[model samples]
Target: MYLKCGLLEDAEKFFGEIPLGNVVSWIAMITGYGKHGLGKEAVNSFNKMQSENIKPDAVYLAVLTACSHSGLLEESQEILLRLCCDSMVKPQVEHFSCMVDVLGRSGWVQEAKNIIECMPIRPNAGI
Candidate 1:
């Protein structure tokens, strides 16, 4: 609710009060931060979630989207690379799309094109 209303501080405070933050709650925080263009906060929340032993699932997309929106090219690339190396989480087409968006937004059109070309899955309209 707070996040939806753009009350990030209130949202963060409430989130911190939760006794046991789950993946879903963490996703909310990350996606909320992304929606507000707070990429650093989103990344910090991602790291905190991991430190709490909450393994990321679809939340990867949220983080990627956050980085893309904030033009964090290097962070996006690092996250993509980490995703590729993590056997637990398989890189999906959506993840690739976010990476492309980040790269393209950062004026790395050729890199974006290369990423699309090397994608294991077929590019969809979303890409």
Candidate 2:
């Protein structure tokens, strides 16, 4: 399978062939791109899903977390900001976790700490 073999291209190809991709399929494709260190590709997948009328769920957000791992500041920040403004997706710990992880890794530890401080749900210990 794509996951077992880490064949992102093949995975995406097959995904594109799917007639009715549900939320789960969308998440899988995005996660596949992310796992392959393709943050922009993951975001593109998210955009494609949206363009095709797929509503992103929390799992989609998780896939987008690859931006943090990949250190894609602008793209990640844009998505986070959009999510915050949309009102459909509330900010959750995992969301904050991705942001914090990105910020901290990018040498913006102070800003990351501030974000954690300002979060509605206080970050769990050991963050």
Candidate 3:
């Protein structure tokens, strides 16, 4: 509720009040921080989620977006790699798009192109 209205502090307080916050709730906070371009906060929330033993899925597109916007390219790449290698979650078109965008924004156009070329599946129009 507070996050939807851009009330981040209020949202945080509410979030902390949710005893044993579930994955959905944690994702909400992460998404909200990302939407606001609070990359560090979003990353911190992600770490907190992991500490709580909440497994993240491909829905971390929000986190990727936040990292890209905040210029956390390394973190974005690490997240993608972790998702691909350590978890059962598969990267979607949205994740690839976000990665390319981040790389391009950071002047790594060639790297972005490499990602497109190396994609396991056919690169979609979005990529």
Candidate 4:
């Protein structure tokens, strides 16, 4: 509610008050924070979600988007690796796109090209 309205603090405060904050709640906060360019807050919320034993599913695309927007390149790379190796989460075209965007934004165009070349699935138009 507040998030969509650009009221980040209010949204975060309301979110924190939820007694049984589920993945949906967390996603709302993360997505809102990301959209607002509050990348660190989004990442922190994600860490807290993990601490609560919430396993991120495909919806973590929001987090990657946040990281990409903020140029959190190293963190994004680590997340990409973890999504592949540790969590067994399938990387979608959106995920790869986020990485490429992050790399390109951070002036690592060569790296982005490398990732596109090495994609397990054929690089889509989005990438």
State candidate 2's TM-score. 0.90
Q: Once superposed on the true structure, which residue ranges of model 1 sit more than 4 Å away at CA?
A: none
Model 1: per-residue Cα lDDT over 57-119, one tens digit each: 888999999999999998888888878888899999999999999999989999999999999
1 versus 2: better TM-score goes to: 1
Q: Give the top-scoring candidate (lDDT).
A: 1
- Model 2, position 61, has a per-residue lDDT of 70
Top-down TM-score ranking: 1, 4, 3, 2
How well does each candidate superpose onto the true structure, as a TM-score?
0.97, 0.90, 0.93, 0.93
Per-residue lDDT of candidate 2, residues 6-56 (tens digit): 987688789879989999887887776777788888888777777987777
Best by TM-score: 1
Which runs of model 3 end up more than 4 angstroms from their true locations?
none
Model 3, 62-102: lDDT tens digits are 78888988888999998888777855677787888888999
Q: How far off is residue 82 in model 3, in Å?
A: 0.7
Candidates in order have lDDT scores of: 0.92, 0.78, 0.85, 0.85
Supply every candidate's count of residue pairs whose N, Cα or C atoms clash at under 3 angstroms: 0, 0, 0, 0
